[model samples]
Target: MEINPAVTFKHDRSIMYAKRPKVLIVGAGLAGLTLGMLLHKADIPFEIYERAQEVKPLGSAMYFNSTTANFFKQCGIYEEFLAIGKYVSSIQVFNEVRGHEFSMDFEGQEAEFGANGYIVARPVMYDLLLRQIPRERIHLGKKVLTMDQGGNGVLLRFSDASEAEGDILVGADGAYSAVRQGLYAKLKKAKRLPSSDDLPLPFSTVCLVGQTRPLTAEEFSDIGLEQCQFRRTIGMEKMYGWATFTTAQNTVAYNVIQFLTDETSKQNDAFRNSEWGPEAAMAMCEQVKDFPIVSGDDKELTLGDLFEWSDKNHISKVMLEEKVFKTWYDCRTVLIGDACHKFSPSGGVGATNAMHDAIVLANRINGLPFHPIAEEIENAFREYKAERVEWVQKAFDSSKAFKTMTGQSFASKATRFVSKHMPAWLFQRIQAQTCANRPQVAFLPLHNDTGRIKPAPQPSLSVRAPVEAETPVAATTATATTTTTEVV
Candidate 1:
């Protein structure tokens, strides 16, 4: 019943693990696949297991920028994207109910800074990544149940009873990662970590996400909705209908409905004791009747409640939790994509951030040893977090600003009279930190290339010598002199 720790490091073939250090990727989604492809290009041996029996092609759009596009190019998967991606020149930011909107032109790649962003379908993107690697290396229907540390390595136990061991274990898995759960249990027991459980969530907010028919070519031309657009239906408060192109087949669409801040409205009653679905969506909508979003004009919006708030402990439930819903992480395990950081799809960055994590980590891992990865891998994670801190904060601040700028409440309407002309410096400062303005950086680890160089030997993440001395030089010195005096 007790599984021992595996301290496996990336290494050369040995008697112990002839096929050791074989990375067992838990999830087969974008992040997992990106990690796999980058490792394969570096000639690192790895295997990815997907819970699903096949590569899933559902889900709607993920906004990808030039950096992500360039990443695809770096991984030798760009042309394929161009083949499937819907390219456009700009994204129109508009009010949902009203026709008023502004457009940001996507300048040329060379003169312009940051990534040329695009909307990607989950399946198309996955299929493209799959093409770059050998099919034999990827396993389907392999569900990872739990894992534990082994001697110099980690053992992965699957539900079907299959197992795998690896030098370094990565939870490239998403936010709700099992690997994250395992690492958190170990780290929390030791208790030198910070409280990540403090992530404040939607104050009595619920999200409704569902797919409807995609846009017709005529609709695209009429709205001038080339890349992406925002439409706000203005009456009193303001709830905008956000629309984006998912796939060319015109089948994938994500319609969102969310409510916030104001909790005492009659609409809250509907969701308070509801089953959490269409009923919830309509109830949330009832509160926003003052500012109605065009449900269906160009096309009808199909909506369904995607996730709900429940406070019950995993299975032991004294009661269903309703405070806020979010997850945290640890050193051995990490939260990637939506699992680590979540956002209000009200302003669609959830999926984009997820893809960005995949690419950022891939760039860092490319051509380098992930095991003895520079302490910067931690920093890369930090930088990734840093990169997101402002971006997400800005997003949150921006979301609040969106409400405040337009005067949501009596207090906001009063505050709205104050600053119509914001300073230019603050705007420039924010623009500077963006991944679009800057390519998110990841570290490249070092390893030997025997076949490519001399026929030396296939290199690996083999464990290195013992931990270098952390003690100060003064402590190690047997004898020391304050001053050099030859006199005696």
Candidate 2:
């Protein structure tokens, strides 16, 4: 991959104006790193602070939609991303009990939207973003203790008794954000805080995620890794699981999620503090060990099969949370990504949304003049939030809806009926239309026209019926095969 000279970091202090308002970004996650990269490319002065000692594989896999792919191409890292990630050509969903199945094809999405949805391990994506940023600009292990805003800028105090000042503060510190807490305290004191910002929304599902060791040819062939197809199995007793293979590593990553719908507050509290480790993950797997993922006449993949093939230490358990705050900014301090809106993993949009937030926020700040006034910065923040709030809410609702549809309930059954019976042409049409309407980075030019901005060609909503529905299977031992083709 050819690296862009303009996108590389340059440590030329002489080019920076002394009077310019420096940006103080909290958190070194996807949102913060992306914002930092944009600031670097635009020749703006900024610094990022992270509480962690270094970047680690904290999460499992993430899916980047067409919109995010465009942003990466603009950042001049799309080729690198392609080498690390796998493009998803189709998604298959099955009702484990009923044996009803549905598959959505994404054959023409790359040409229509300029890119298809790509999936990569979270740690790999984090490292890729980190590589584009200068190490000096990122400070690790500096946990923020408090924040104070003065007439000209904001002051930050760290846990190590260190202090820093900046003209603008950005809180991309994720859901449990200290900056958000500080901003909320100030807002409440001024009687400007909304009631929704007082507490986090409760999450009821527990997820165990892990990646298996490299698979042999037979093992890989049985799992059917064609353009990295995503398979989701909706089983009995509110158990759901998803599986996909990583191209670069030749490993299969899977998530086993169980929904705790009727648990009391006491049980929830106990579960929250429960020790999560390999034992817990294996215990969860034992409960659904026999749950069928892909069943054929001679081949069957189950939860226990994948668990047995995984590295014990790599397995992790986490409770999924969902929320979208009513407030995103308070004066000079603004929140992004999970800090403002968090999504359940059902839709695989959390990281994508975070990346989008970075692009939009960077565009707004990039338009500001050097040494922008407080009022000017505030207006830019407002515009950023106003442009993003509706889309984030829509994505949040969609994720929740997907979670409901993939569960063992009346709604889930109804959704299965629709999914099983929906025509392939119709599904493709809807997907194409959705992809066509996806948002783009307003400031970045199209991939082909890197030197100038060109309006994206409006894709036609024409649908093709290339994907065929397989016959429903009644016997557990019967084989159900779906044809696979490379779309990328």
Candidate 3:
């Protein structure tokens, strides 16, 4: 009936929930589940909390980075994931103005850096990661309400009238992260992104996802679905991006998901419930339902249902433009994955970066001494946040730029120039390299551009993905002087 505060305790492995310095992972989504798996691999005791009554199939599919493949391989699920996802040779970007012309292309093995890139269904990905952990470790239907830190450690409270204590608490509950909000409230006395009144760009958009009737290899080839493909809007006016979800060589998924950015400005936080609306989110699924993408037999369609994701319908009603997001943690409590950072789905780093957070944190947990583990909570969190925030910020910046460019701003002729001149290869390579590598200054979130460097001694974290210094920093210029690979 009444809620309590968070406290710290000496976690004892003998008892499951009593483990001191125990990890409380909120939001059982990709980040939470992956973090649990990594901790499990390192023999660390952790508890994952999810507010969902059950894992719901909200979005259609997710895109995985090549680096993520390494984590998956480490988890011994690389092959299994390969089975569920669409593995493509490359990711191609095209300029729609040039008759949907090709612009950039990134190809090759992720092993050079870490993992391979793939597109997979959100639910399936969630289920796969969830399977890696024991049923007891993940507590569903538990919503985090708040967290408190004393001299010793931290205590966590849930809306379900439940309380737990640990040395470190991770807010993995996603964009509307309670732990993050609670921690930031206590630590900074200020709100974080998404949770605040920061309204996402009012530009309207539709997310259409569905299961198709499966496609033949010939049909797929005809549509140029051989490898992963992308098509940008003309003059970057309409954000149209789609990829194939091929798990096996011949097995094309009947389910294809497409994201299209528009400027129709539908009402904020409203899910268009019509089976078919002018801006139905699942229209892409409907559009391709009869496509040749098939599983095995032509009789069965890979699709089970069509769905849409609206800001209002999201588990967390936060948007990319939201300034005060889910939550923030300093010291005893911390937030990771979507719980801490929510970017435009277009960023494509949401799942990958979240998994990265879990993996990197898990690695540190495995490497730390048990005694220091409890006290060194900040150290581990620092490492995770440092690396994750920078990368996530990059992802966010990219998504926002792309959204702005393609959202059809009549006043914006800059989008036209960018589409006509900027080399698509540059973006693809930049993303691939960034996702696959980490920078030495991984801990700091602020950019050291134009004399913004910090003299802090950087540690070796295998994160030198090249984009930190190599690519253009959130700026597009005229003349296109950079000698980037001109793919189109």
lDDT of each: 0.45, 0.70, 0.50
Candidate 1 wrongly placed segments (more than 4 Å) = 1-20, 53-56, 88-96, 101-110, 198-204, 210-241, 244-252, 260-332, 363-432, 435-488
lDDT of 2 by residue, 1-488 (tens): 22121333432333544344679999999999989998888667899999878765655677876766666877889899988888887677766653647776677666666677777877788899999999999999899998987545788999988888887899999877889989999889989988878865567777778777767657756334546747777776654655544545666777777777565334545655322656766677777777776632346667787778877777777767788999898667889998889888887878878877887677667655455545556766776776677668878887887787778889978976786788878876655544443444455564452212222332111111111231222211121011001100
Best by TM-score: 2
Q: What is the lDDT of residue 466 in candidate 1?
A: 17
Candidate 2 lDDT (Cα, whole model)?
0.70
RMSD of every candidate to native, in Å, equals 10.9, 14.5, 11.9
lDDT of 3 by residue, 248-359 (tens): 3332222232333332234434543212343443334455433322222233232322122122132121223312232344665667776666566555666777776776
Question: Any runs in candidate 3 off by more than 4 Å, and if so which?
Answer: 1-20, 89-99, 109-116, 188-266, 269-328, 371-375, 410-488
Question: How much is the lDDT of residue 340 in candidate 2?
Answer: 88
TM-score of 2: 0.82
